[model samples]
Target: MQIPEVGEPAPGFTLPGTTVRDGARTDGEYALAAEIGRTVVLAFYPGDATPVCTAQLCSYQEELDDFGDLGAVVWGISPQALDSHAAFAHGSSLTFPLLSDPAGDVVRAYGLVAPGIGLRRSVFVIGPDGVVRWRHVGLVGLRFPKAATIRAQVEQLVA
Candidate 1:
């Protein structure tokens, strides 16, 4: 499946995930459709605790307040189990949710499945209206967009 383009409706999904709340790991189902009226950032990474993925998510966590100020919620998705996500979030002190896509269902839905990598490092910013406003899909998983760049994209949506 081709990735959703900017101005196109983001594919909706509900995935079980783990999030850090008050320094505790909580498990729940996150539904994209439930976030319809809010700007959402969907970040797809290859795995949890990997070097690049760690740096990428931690950087986003550092600027999480800025994203919150812009009314955007960020979600990290990977083809790992919930236990792995919980451990990664706890070890990394990640406050945002890390969704478990063990079957790669959501990854396939977003057209981010890579041959050996499982999933590409990608980020999609969805506007409050549920349309994709900006995206970056890494051909090589070594790098990812900076938090400021993603914030700017969300800012454009609300501006």
Candidate 2:
């Protein structure tokens, strides 16, 4: 599957997701279409609680305010269960939603899954017009875009 290209409409998704708040887990469904008027940061990782994924998400958590300041709504996507996402969010103190894509439909939509491993780490920045403005799909899943880079793209795209 081809990853959605820049200037293209981001693939729409509505998945069950989980987030942490005040040490409590909140579960809900998130839809890409629901965020049409705001910048959206979609971070797709392999699973919950892995070392590099942990670092990536924790960095996002630590700098989430910057994303908000840029008018971006951030979310994490993985092929785990909502329960797993809830646990991970609680453990990592993630303030944003971590979407569960157990069927990998969203992963396939974003062209993120590979043969051996599951989801190759990927990031997509969708502008307020619902078009993809920036994207990075990791070749080896070792690294992803930092929050600052995402914020910059959000500012540039939404400006």
Best by lDDT: 1
**Structure candidate 1, residue pairs in collision:** none
Question: Distance from true position, residue 76, model 2, in Å?
Answer: 0.2
lDDT of each: 0.93, 0.90
State the lDDT of candidate 2 residue by residue for 11-50, as single tens digits.
9989998888998788898999999999999999998999
Give lDDT for model 1: 0.93
Steric clashes per prediction:
0, 0
Q: TM-score winner among the candidates?
A: 1
Off by over 4 Å in 1: none
Taking all chains together, each candidate's TM-score versus the true structure is 0.98, 0.97
Model 2 lDDT vs. the true structure? 0.90
Off by over 4 Å in 2: none
